[model samples]
Structures are given as C-alpha cells and as structure tokens.
Target chain A: MSIDNPETMETPTGEALAEAPILTEVLPELPTVMDEQDLIIETRNLSKRYGRLQAISNLNLQVPRGAIYGFVGPNGAGKTSTMRILTTLMKPSGGEAYINGYSVVTAPREVRRSIGYMPDFFGVYEDMKVWEYLDFFAACYEIPEAQRPGLINDLLELVDLAHRRDDMVDKLSRGMKQRLCLARTLAHDPQVLILDEPASGLDPRARIEIRELLIELAKMGKTIFFSSHILADVNEICTHIGIIEAGQMVAQGPIKAMRQQLMPHRVLVITLLGRLDEAKEALLHVEGILGIVDLPPEDGKIRIKVEFTGEDLRMSEMLQALTSKGIPVVNFAEESSDLEAVFMKATKGIVS
Target chain B: METPATRTRISLNPLRPLLRNPVALKELRGRMRGPRAFVVLTCYLIVVGGFTTLLYIAGTAATYNTTGEVDGGTLGRVLFGSVVAIELFLVTFITPAFTAGSISGEHESQTYDLLRTTLLPERQLVFGKLFSALAYVFLLLLAAIPLQSIAFLFGGVDVEEIVISLLVLLATAIFLGNIGVYYSAMTHRTLRANIMTYVTILAVILVTTAGAVIALAIVEGLDPSTSSSGSEWVLLVARGIFVCLNPLTTLLSTQQYLVNQQTLFTFKYTFTDGTTTTLPSPWIAFTIFYLLLSVVVFFATTRHLKRIEG
Candidate 1:
C-alpha cells in the first residue's frame, strides 16, 4: 500500500494525540543495522523530482540515536530537499522515510512531533521581543502553558542566549539569530534535529559555538542530521558522514571506515640519518614496498608507498631489511588521510 | 514497579488550529494598533455624530409655509433615510480598505510560508484573518453606537430598531471582510486584490441595483394598481436579495436599519391570463433571507481556505 494513502484511510479525526499502537513481541533475529541503538530516522529509496530535474534520487540514509550525522553536500546537491522530506515540510515524489518508525507521508504529525527542523533562511517576526517569539513557538508545539517558562529558559541557556531573551529578534546579530532559531527548534524537546546549513554565513567563532552545541546535544542522545559545506567542521564532530553529489550519495559510511576503504594502501615518508642512497636502493629492493620516491636534494628524505595486504609481518620484514643495510631510520611514519583527501578522492571533483 | 512497554503513541489535533490560533487575535491587535484604523474610526464617529446633530435640528424645524412641527413618523423617516445614506457611503469606503491587503499582504511580505510552517491548518489561518479583520470592523461600528443613540434622543426611535440596525451593520462588515479574504486568497498581489475587490463590489452593486430596477418596473408595468401601492418596498426587497448574496447588498442592509419606517411594498400583480395576484411582507422576507445568505458566504470563505495549495 502506498504511504500517501494509509491502509484504513481514516481521516485525522481529532486534535488529541493518537492512541499508542500495541507492540506484541520483540524479534531478536532482526540483526543490528547501522548501529544496534535506536534509529531516530531512516529512509529507503527516497526520491524527489522537479519536472525533469531530479533534485534527490535513490537516497538512503540512517541516523542512529545520539549520533551527529553530517550530510555534507554542495548547493543544489539536494540537502534541503532531503531535510524537508524528513521534516514533513515537503512530500517526496517517490519512496518513503520514517521518523522513529513513523511513516513521513501517512503519519506526518507524528514525524513532526519527533523532529525539529531549522531551515537555511527564515524570517523572524521582528515586532515581537525574544521571549514572545519563543513563547509563540512553544505554543505552536502544543507545549503546556505551565511548563513552558522553564522549558523556554532551559532552551535559552542551551543556546547561550538567555541574556538577550528580552531583546527583539531583529536586533540580534546573525549568529544570535541563528542561535535563537536553534533554541526555538528545541522548544518541543524533539528527539531528532534536522538543521540545514546551520553554520552557513556565520563567522568562525559563531560556527564553533554552533558546532559545540551540536556536540553537546549529541552527547545528550539527540539524533542530529546536520548538512554543511564545511568539511573540516564535519570531520571534527560528525561520527558518520554522507557525501552527496548530483542528487545521489557518492559515498556514505562511518568516516573512518570510508577513509580506510579508499586508502587501504598507506604511504610512509622516512628521513634517514645516514646511508640515504643505499636506503632508497634497499627500499626499492624490498618485496612488500610498492613504490619509492626520493625527496629532492634539498629535502633529504625518502618517501615509500606500503600496501598492507592483510599481512602483519610485511612492515617488520622491510624495516629489518633496511636496518640490515646499515640505513639508520630517523623518522618513519604512515601518513593518515584527512577527511578532505578522502572526500576529494571519493567524489572525484563531481560536486560542482 | 512500572513495567516498560514497547509502543507508539499518535494523535491528531484537528481543532488544534481553532482553539489557540493566534492569527485572529494577532490581526485584531495589529489592526487596532495601526494609525489607519484609528483615523478611519475617528472620522466615522465625527461624521456620524455631526450628521445626527444636523438631523435633530432639521427635524425640529417648522415648515416654511405652514409654521408647524413635522409629525413624529415623518421625523423618524427622515432620520432613518439620512442614517442609512451615511452608513452606505461610509461602508463603501471602509470595507474595501479593511480587507484589500488581508491575504495579499501576507503573500507580499513573504509571511505566508512562515504562517503555513507553524502547524496551524489552512482553514484556521483563513478564518483567523477574516475574523480578525471583522473584529476591527466590529470595534469601529461599536465606536459609532453613541452617535447612533442621538436618534433615540427624539423619542421616536425604538431600541429594538437600533439593535436591528447595528446587527445589520455587523453582518455587512463580516460579509465584506469575507469577500476581502476570498479575493486575497485567490490573488497574489495586494494591488490586484484591491482592484479586484473594489471592482467586484462595484459590479455587484451596479448589476443588482439595475436588476432590481428592471424587476420592479416589470412588476409595476404589469399591474395598474401597484403604482398607487408603491414600488420602493419592492425595489428594497430586490436590493436586499441582491445584497444577501452580493457583498454590496450586505453593506446596503445596514442602511435599512438607518431608515425609520422601512417601506413595505405591496404588489397587485396581473398574469398573462389577466388574473390578479397580491403579495405582502416582501421586504421583511427578502431582508431576512439575504442575512442568511451572508452566513453562507462566511462558510464559503472558510471552505476555500481549507484546500488552498500555496
């Protein structure tokens, strides 16, 4: 059955929360996918097309509980479309997504309850003061009037904007406005957060503050699906990364795993104390060493490429052979591939 | 000890929209806080009050030739006529401006999308705005009550008649507000909505008044006896029917209350076979029928907002 039309076709009958569906029994055989922890959001084959142009195509994403999953993509790569789909703001043309197992199409109200979405750009009613704006959204979220004051303060403190709680939103700096938006999104205490370009247009300090806030929220077990063009920021914080290009996931997995997957062969650059020419000749003669590049005469270092073929003794054997040749190794270490290198190699300059 | 259960809870708030929807309250506050609403209301009060004073002075004037006071019923009719005429003129100017920018203004300011994302249903948004605009109109009308009470100083104006007049005015304001909402929703620009709203009001007034005149003429031309019985009442009834379904006529209905003795027209009709027909109470029946039509219009506006895509 299509999700747009639920099986029973029961029109949303009332304003009260729907009754909880009874869970019969647990199936232990359903193995852990992604992480064994709770899946706050998951999508399979979600596609959104505008006319002939595919904005998002065949997208699959999983956001585990308490993880800050960064969706890194360039503009027009369908980051906003995916966020809109998950937030129940826009319907997908094909496929489906679930928020905490609630179907986005058939059960949008529930999905909305479970997620707080902050768009890239939005207007705040400038006529109202900070407290009134937060109070208004709290009401929209159906927060009880009695408990709202405390929740509002907590959120304000969380976003570090309690001092300007009385100031008009329009008077706030771009960073402060962004922080206020984040606080507003947290008013309902949603389990999952979808922030589109949260760090966009912010100065370095403000971006760092937003980054720290997301990390704190993650520590508190909130599932965060944040999209950004800032790869360095994502690398610093996000445990899982999804790189999108041309409305398709070019590469998506644990950052470490994806890096390992691409660069299985590690390169070692060694600067020697003595016997440099002999060391280069001996490294070339070593069986396990794939390639060797001698540094320029000014640099005085030899770089060797070593491919680990699931063998433990290969590196030791090469080192023993080099030592036997009387080549004293001064500094020898394998170069680690940063996220930027991994991302560049995997995407192959297709983002533009 | 409480047992842990694996389950999911879901519920929908249908009227989550209407109960605490802020649009109506916010719009009311916005309109009332504005300089335009204040200026319009103050002007209406001064005109209504000043006109009533002039009416009182005129009604007390002795005839130029006879040197005697006019009868109470004559004074009543004069006051009613003047009041209705004033209301008609004032409403024509005020109604369009109140509703012209309602929907279109939001679109222009780019606040429509912001409103939609707030989880408030579309119907609530439409009705909230419509009601808020009407509430301001209601306040404006309320401000005119003391001015209207000047008619009661003459002792001929009944309280019931005054109440009925105010009710009619209220109905007209609500009906006109809905017209503004409907057009605002349909059009994208404030300029277009304003032009269309004014054009719509003018078209309805011209068409209905012309139709009433033609219908009255046809009814009168068919019967020789009807000329003596009067055609004003029949024209009023036709106009009321038009106003009930037409927003302009709704505005005109408030004028009916401004008049002291509503002319009840009687028609002695002649069929093609040369038989005569008699009709009574056409004005009352038609006026009431039109009032009902105004309610239906409010419902129609609400329904239109429910399915609005953008």
Candidate 2:
C-alpha cells in the first residue's frame, strides 16, 4: 500500500523471490530452482500451426524479471496464440516455451503455479457473490482454506472491489467485473501475470485505472506481461515492448532504447522573442546539429527546430552557447518521439 | 493476522478441504442460490405427487370393481412399479439437460480458456462437471423417495425391491450423466452436444432391445419347438446380454426378481461345443457394466479435452 517505499520499489532478485519460504511450502512438489536464467519468460523458436495457417513462427522472446512487457501486434497477428502457448493453455506445433524455468509443455503445472493468466474475454459465474468467486479460484490454486479469507480480502482491496464483496458478480458493471477478474488472478500471489488485453473494452477512465493498477503491481515486484493494441496505453506504462507482425517479431527492446533506435535524431524546438535568426545561426554552428528547420511565428516570436544527434552534455552545451550569445531565448525543449509512430514504422501491416 | 483460535478451528474441520472442489462447490452454490432451481424442484414434486395420487386412485378402483376386496399387495406392486418407472423417465430426461451443456457452456461464455489455465487438471474439470450435474439429479431422485416409500406402506413392496430399484435408477443416472459430459467435451455447441447425448442414450435403450427381440424371433423360428431344451438357453443368453445393456430391462428385471425371486436369465445353456455358462443377474451385471462404461467415457472425455485445450 505504501507506493513510495524504496524497499518495495526495488525489484527483488529472481533467486531470492523464487526461494521465498512461503512459496516453497505452498508448492512443495515444484523444484526449488526451475532455471537460473535472469529472464522470467523465454520462448525459443515457438511456433503454432492450425492446419495450414501458421499462427506463430520461430518466435524467440525474452522478458526479464520485473518488467512490464507490452506485447503489441496487429489483429490476428497471433498475439493471443503466443500468450496461450506461454500460459500452457495451448501447445505449440513446434518448439517450446518456458516460464520461470519450467517448460510449458513438460512442466505445465509448475508453469501454471508461477503465472496468473487472464484471457481477453472471460466469463464469471453470475450467481456467485464476488467474494465467493474469488474463494473458488483460490481453492483452485490450492491456497489453504484458512488463508483464503485473508487473501480474498487483500485482493479485493487491491482491485478496489472490497465494497462489492457481497454483491452478485453479474450485477457489477463491466469495469467492476474486469477488476474483480483481476483480483481473482492475484488470489495465489503469482510471480508473473499474463494478461491478454486487460483493457480492451473499457472506457477511457477504466483503461486508466487498469493501467495504473498494472504500474502498482510492477512496483510490487510482479512481472506483468500483458498484450494490448492500444499504443497509447502501452506507450504510457510499458518499460519493455515487443512488436509482432505476420507471426514474426519485428522489434523488441526497452521503450527508451526502442525510441532511440527508431528515431535516431532528436528534435529540439527553440522559441525566441528576439534575434530568432541569430539563435538559429548560433545553433547551426553546434557540432551535433544535423539541420535547422524553420517554423512560423507564434505570438510575435519565432520558433526554430533543430535536428540534433548528440548526447545530453552536448545539448546542454549548445543551450549554454545560445544563452551566452546575448540572444533572448524564451523556451528550449526537445519533443519526445511518440510510441505510436515507432510502432507504425516497425510493423509492415502484415497479419496472419 | 493469524489468530490461534481461528487456526485451530480450521485444522479441526477435516472435511473442509475435501468438500471444496472448486467446480462442484461453485456449481452447487450457484444452483442453490438461483430461483430457477427452486422452481424446477417444485414443479418436479408436483408432477410426481399428482402421478402418485392418480396411480393410487386408479389401482384402488380397479381392484374394488374387479374383486370383492382390495388387494394391498397387488396395489403396492402397481404403485411402486409406476413410481419407479416415472422416476427412471425423469432422470433420463433431466440428466442430459444438466450435464450436456456444462463444458460447452463454459466455452460459449468465454470462460473455457480461463478455466484451462488454472491449476485444475483436465480429469478434475470433467469429473467436477459430471459430479455436480449428478448431484442435482441425485437430489431429484432422493426427493421422490417419499413417493416411492408410499408403496412400502402397502404389503407387496419390500426393502430389497426398493434398494434394487434405487440402484438401477442410480446406475442409469451415472450412465446418462457420463454420456452427457462426454458429448459436452467433444462438441463446441451445447445444442449439438445435448442432441447427440440424447441420441446415444436412445440408441443404447431402443436399438439394443430391438436387436435382441429380432434375434430371439429368428432363433425361435429356427427351432419351432416350445420345449425346455438346451437350445432354448441360446435365446435366454441373448436376451440377458441385451437386457444388461438396456436401462429399462435392468430396472424391470430387478422388479421381477423382487416379485418372483427369479433371475432374469433362468435357463442354463450347454452348447454342442461343450461350453456351459449361466448369465449373471441383470442388476448386478448392469451395475458393473454401467460403471465400467462410465469410466471409459470419463477418460475419453478427459483425453479429448487435454488434446484440444493443451
């Protein structure tokens, strides 16, 4: 609940988290160390074929521990198929997937215990009360009856559904039901959450709430691997991203790294109240300045955009040089590249 | 926040975990909470009650008009047989409705993927749906026991008859329930599954009986003698095999044993090839056969589910 706690902010080491005594006791049948790999989710040449239609082909993905990985793809580009294979709900026609070191095909039970999966479209028992629904799933995970009450309470509070604990699940709004389903996923306190389109059909406010919840869960050291086509949502929250097109991984990396790779040059917009031409002339002399683009005046002030391929220090030095030139500099800021643009450029609009 | 008192309470409740099968518990809780279950139960009871009263009145009047006195033993047999027969019909009609939609319903509602991802195994999922549906059918059977017991108050119905009838009824429910669950797992559409389940049940009942009857008529024509000879044993064994396969024959044979203390297959067979055998009693044979068949169907369902979902 303490969002700003530094201890909670730090991502726990995979080994340390895997060796938690409570988890070991709850899942005694699973091996102590599934894999020594730093990646929490890994797939090697994972392919799925439905007759002649290949859903996924040679997908090699590595999601590090404690990463909010955004899986992006066009419709019917096999995002769901990949997630299904990873969750052990479906088998790949060829290759394999591993979660927390356990093979999805050979050690599905261990894989299931490590991840909580929420499908794109899921249904709840309408006649069950909210708390009872959670209790049923908790039992499915083999959480002890004695602990279920407390776990259910904490999950309800986390998803903001505590007030509707006694209400029938069907009576809740679509957004509330989605959150309740999220709470159900957290019943066993899984190390990773594989959510498929968690905010697919929600309104703007509901999508924001779901986005914030994912952030909170990441802060608590849970690896969140969710798929979404909503580029805006992924752009705002995802630390890591993987873009798939035509059953192939087109691009994947940290968000910051991806932005840099796709948009190599940074655009710096400088607004000057006076001597705009002098500021532009001075910026042109800076070493990293690739080009200077002219812009129309706003409020009797001129704006010039500089295409700079430089490090942070060089940009600061260029700003200092402009200030030292005695030119009236009103505002100088860099326009951050949008993720949507990067996604559009990376994918070829191919779908399988 | 572990309170010593609450922890002790949990540990002492040994049945807590055993009773908490997620699918069964959820199904039962949902079923009992809804008004539809209550409405169905009420309608079932009313229909049974009305039928029982009608059978009693009709039997009493027929006996009084035909004879100088009303024979309670005959009346008892008539009432018990009618009530058991009605119950068999009800169970056969209702078991498919409850089970055939279980798995397919999950898919239709878009919950099947979520369920498959859980720690619950395929066998547990299939059995959970099976047991939950059977539990409701068993409740319906239990509710009709009072009507069945009404015949016991008269002279002819004995404890053995009631037990045997109940066994046959239960075996029929198990068989039909398994069929329903099997089809549910195999088909994606609930309507198709339910239709196939009923078709399979009808085939088991009607086709086997018809086949046996036709085979018996042909064998009788070949011999053309009403003699109590070894050749007659062939006809008896054929009837026994088909009778064991048919639910109606199984229940009726149990009823006949209660009334006459005779096995369904009485004649012994000694073939010209020097083989000699006597068929087992219909109730016992059918119970074992039905249970074995159920196990086969249950596994088939689980295997199909795993192959498709995994």
Task: Name the candidate that leads on DockQ.
Answer: 2
Instruction: Report chain A TM-scores, every model.
Output: 0.81, 0.80
lDDT of each: 0.68, 0.81
Best-matching candidate per TM-score: 2
RMSD to native for every prediction? 11.9, 8.3
Query: lDDT winner among the candidates?
Result: 2
lDDT of 1 at A53: 87
Model 2 chain A weakest 10-residue run by lDDT: A24-33
- Candidate 1 docking category? incorrect
**Model 1 chain B weakest lDDT span, ten residues long:** B1-10
lDDT of 1 by residue, A1-352 (tens): 2222121232244321133121111211211224735667788999999889899999988777767788987888899888878877678988889999999888877877788778887666645668767777777777765666778778889999989877877899998888888888887788888898998887555665787788778776688889988777677778788998878888887677878887776666666766766877776666666667655443655444444443546666668778897788867666566777777787756557
Q: Write model 2 residue lDDT over A38-80, tens digit each, in one string.
A: 7999999999998899889999888888888999998888899
Clashing pairs in 2: none
lDDT of 2 by residue, B196-288 (tens): 999998888888789678766755565434444455566666777887788777777666654574444342344434466665568888888
